[model samples]
Target: MMTSAKREAAPANGRRLILFGAFDRHNFGDLLLARCAAAGARTDIVFTGLAARDLRKFGGFHTLALADAIAAFGSEDADFVHVGGELLTTTAWEAAVMLQSPSDTARIVALHDRSPDARTAWARSVLGTTRRIPYIVAQDDLPTRWRTHFRAVGGVAFDTLPGAERNEILRALRTATTLSVRDRTTFDALRHAGVDTDLLPDPAAATPALFGATIGQRGQGGEIAALRSRMRSWAAVQLAAEWGDDATLDRVAGSLLATSAASGTGIVLYRAGLAPWHDDLDTLRRLADRLGAQRPVAILESAHVLDIFALLAEACAYVGTSLHGWIVAHAFKVPARCLVRGPADKAARYTDTWCDVPRQWRTPEDGPLFPETISG
Candidate 1:
């Protein structure tokens, strides 16, 4: 269990320890980082700051530059300073740049581990620098080269993959300051490597409650009832059009239509991610046309992330291509069928760790894993 920092003495200067992260955007995944930091902090000296480039149109959180963040760390300050969330792998330089800031005073904690996307040249450059980072409390799905590189950084909690790089990662994790992983694969890998590792639930498991609380805070809890009242049994359908073409989406829509007909369930089409590179608004429109009034489908192109989750909570089951969509559905114990778009998709990786049933569908016709007729 993670313990709270009990500082012997208060800081000489009365400044709250700043909780830093790459929350420059409105991504709920990053928001989870800030929420976890808030949950862990003890003193009122808690300020949330974004270390990444601010892409959000508008937000109330404080933005911290490298210099400003360093100033917040008092030499004798208890382990109050935390660098939490998924910033470690989203943008290559996020972890490197955030940790590069000069400060030995604060204890920096990296909350979730997503190995850097090291396939790119820029990612490789950043991975080279990430070795300088001391410790990270990470998730299990790190890439091979990234894991091999992370070996030197030591303190990490990850799952082991079967590959040539296994030996190197084992050696690195063996010297780690702490080793805890979210999956049995990681635990077995570490044990086989002659290292001890503890199994823990992934951070994504905890976000539904946090997401729900965020919804209540925004005064949208009432809206869930209003939305739920519109449908008999809403099954949220989320797909990433960026990964596959229009044909792929048509297949998913067709599958959903069939399922709706079979189960008399209503359909709610929504987008979980808001990155400009991967918008599903147009895709949802195409899907609606495909459904063509056979079943009533509501389009939520502009729903808040928590609003989407709220709808999912009230959902009969969730069927989607978004990894977070599946994670959120499972977290809420809402029946879910995660559509794995690609073989190496993160959603598939995560499903392997958590769900015992065959929850992943490669083809739309493979059907919802937890059909309403069969689900409890």
Candidate 2:
């Protein structure tokens, strides 16, 4: 460790900071939240997210769904519950307030979403951790992003060894490896504290098994395409029926491994939420035939939870409908082209989250990419 500050160690237990946000959607911020909130103990990721994959590699220390979360933690026993990220809608705020494991959970809601104003006092009052840790981690980058609409007011910069501040941190965090800033000052401080851990790539794979990436790539486009192409040649592609779950994706994947000679181009046409839309099996067959036409696709059902990330990462190029496919494809830097039900649908939230990553050339085709309704 040689360059900057210390990693934000998850605070001691009983001092757990429960964060509630829209983690189910697979958006960048959601992924970032899922990846970041597990820094300290007693930490639980309460999400309304669509993903059911292993988040530990992506920093999911302790995760629970909102429906199953109430029993997991109540509002009367903890020191505080810090509101995480820029989520301040009525439901999000309400959920954030209720996530406290203690009834006396002091709400230290960060002003990251919008600064606390007199008008929002009621919402702020509902928080449980403010009294214990009123201080907000409003980093330098945030001020520039929110100079006018909101204010940090009395907050600190977000440079608390930010996982995504630089490549090393991102890679380490992404892989779930122990990471300290790569500078002498930071390393010496931790070493003196008797905390030494070997560094390994975060278990979350960066390069897809079928892609061209020999290195780190997250937000870059060309890198993803190359990676996907690489997977197309090396890894097994599970062409799941667009409506089947992850389990079907696995079976289809198994079929590829079993039937096809290992040319590294096995694809499964897995289906997720799309199964219900088709009225009959024949219609689904027709649709799947068309959807799976351009590339080599085989009909498979949606997959189970555990295999989604690995299965997607194993592929170099993912041409599909599900948001998870797009995300896993993009995370490994595999070139992903989505045929989302709606152009700017909620499913697009994940892709859209990282949509701004690659610097795309301006063209008539690009106009649709930039949603006009959001161009305020």
Candidate 3:
């Protein structure tokens, strides 16, 4: 675990720690990061996100809007911790769009798409920031008395951003009281930019150690209970909406069909996030349709974060495009493989940085799904 002397001193000074990240949405990794940060903090903590959202139904915190949370602290001493995630490359427009309800996302996206001025106006209206990278707040955005800390955050594609945006992110990191990155790719990029940072594993790697029992208990009830009762043995499968095209789905379905035939285990498909660009029920349904009832393939429609954890925890193996799915599965010592677009993909970069085991990455063009090592 990564500990800081600043965090240790905060309790003595009675400074409340405002834990901030992408927790306002339903992404499994972001929600898990919030829980892990809260569980590990020594002082009182408040959860803040891009928007004020109550996600308790999904096993997440009642998150406050970034601006509101900062204002509430006023001149009081506090520690602002950017909890964790691939937060660096997210633009203002992307963040704002993800926070909107699925129904409102299409109209908002269309409006933003039509005009650059409209995009800026809508992003500013929703996020309360004009900065291109709104998620990583600079010192000017906070109270003068508050301190900043960033813990094990990932930004694998930081090098691909424009110079001005890169400088913006650098300015934010330079002001942090303590800064650490989750992947070597991000660390090397920042280092080349003249900013030094500690390299650490993603915070979610500690999920099994911190919340193993709680997660297991959560599985004993609700939708997870029903799933557990139904599948005697299964492999947890998940993919983002970006891979939902017919051709990609056919490739994935073919690989999965062969795996099911060989192992005689059922397939359980789950959504890792409900944000606009994350997972899609329709996409998962499409993949399921291609599977065509060859075996007991089931779609887990639950959005609860721990339920997602429980499903992965109880699986015979995990195969997906989600980094967190691989992280959680690896945490529980479950055999797993992560699907990636290429070597530069975030999941691929992360595994390259920290995974000691040989990686078996299945891309869209790959024929076989799981390697011989990942078996039921």
**Best-fitting candidate, scored by lDDT:** 3
Backbone clashes for every candidate come to: 3, 73, 0
lDDT of 2: 0.34
User: Model 2: runs farther than 4 Å from truth?
Assistant: 1-12, 17-266, 272-284, 291-296, 321-324, 340-376
Query: Ten consecutive residues with minimal summed lDDT in candidate 2?
Result: 147-156
| Overall lDDT per candidate, in order of appearance | 0.50, 0.34, 0.85
Task: Using TM-score as the measure, name the better of candidate 1 and candidate 3.
Answer: 3
What is the full ranking by TM-score, best candidate first? 3, 1, 2
Taking all chains together, each candidate's TM-score versus the true structure is 0.63, 0.35, 0.94
Write down the RMSD of all candidates, one decimal each.
Answer: 9.9, 16.1, 2.9
Could you tell me which residue pairs clash in candidate 3?
A: none
lDDT of 1 by residue, 151-171 (tens): 101112233233423444444
lDDT tens digits, residue span 1-376, model 3: 1233222122335888888899999888889899988885775678998889999999899999987887788578888888889988888888999998888888888777889788878899988777898879887678998888888888999989989889899989888888888898998898888788888899888888898999889989987788778777888999899999898899889888888878878899999998888999999999999999787899998888888989989888889999999999988888888999888888988888888875656677665777555455
Question: Distance from true position, residue 89, model 3, in Å?
Answer: 1.3
Clashing pairs in 1: 16-45, 113-138, 113-139
TM-score of 3: 0.94
